[model samples]
Target: MIKPIVKDQQLLAKKAVPATKTDRPIAADLIDTLNAHQTECVGMAANMIGSNKKIIIARLGPLNVVMFNPQITAKSNPYQTEEGCLSLIGKRPTKRYQKITVKFFNQAWQPQTLFLTDFAAEIVQHELDHCNGIII
Candidate 1:
């Protein structure tokens, strides 16, 4: 289902909780929502759909990567750029890392690690910020 994007600042400011096995559906929902808005967005987080779970779907080129309980284990080389959010008003200048290593669960609930760089890393960081209750 493509859930409505939450626009409430107070709600978006609340930190998302880690996902459990039961929250697997949220991952699918995130992917569906991202696909529905593929042209307008590169990523969607569980919190954006009003479910405060640590889940995010990011479009890295032609692929939609769905992750649960995602956390940035390492990052390097900071860079500043403008970014927009589906749940926020306008684009804002944000700082992001050029490279990042994340630990997360796949859609099947298996542990996964990804080494990302450039735009892919930036997109993941943006979604991760949503999980941490930050909008930029």
Candidate 2:
């Protein structure tokens, strides 16, 4: 059974993560979680959901950047911005990075890089924060 995503239940590891193949069931649960919170987007991995392996899931179109055990290789200085998290429904604005770049192996184990800005940028930050047991 899928457990409630208290977010704190499974901590985000500080080390680089590996990718695990996200089966349809887990992906569907992520979708359900996203929808349950009325979240517009989500970036998740099997590990982030409680499994300790590299697998990622996102809800953005054309950005089907499902990665296995992804990590942020680069990020800009924090400038803070209004942010909300699925774990925390009502939220306050805070400063975050203006830009961030990540590197991770795809489902194929090939190295990949992704650059993000604006909403996606924040989304990545929020999701990655979960990887490190952080919530913003």
For all candidates in order, the CA lDDT equals 0.90, 0.59
Worst 10-residue lDDT window for candidate 2 reads 15-24
Give the alpha carbon lDDT tens digit for every residue of 1-136 in model 1: 8889899989888999988999988877888888888878999889999899989999988889899999999999999999987777788999999999999999888999999999999999999999999967
Q: TM-score for candidate 1, please give it.
A: 0.97
Q: Which lDDT tens digits does candidate 2 get at residues 17-92?
A: 5445444345555555555544444666454456545455565554455555567777786776766554457776
lDDT of 2: 0.59
Model 2 bad stretches (over 4 Å): 1-4, 7-40, 45-48, 52-54
RMSD vs true structure, all candidates: 0.8, 3.9
Q: State in Å the error of residue 113, model 2.
A: 0.9
The regions of model 1 sitting more than 4 angstroms off are none
Task: Evaluate residue 135 in candidate 1 and report its C-alpha lDDT on the 0 to 100 scale.
Answer: 69
Q: Please provide TM-scores, in order, for all candidate models, with all chains considered together.
A: 0.97, 0.66
Best by lDDT: 1
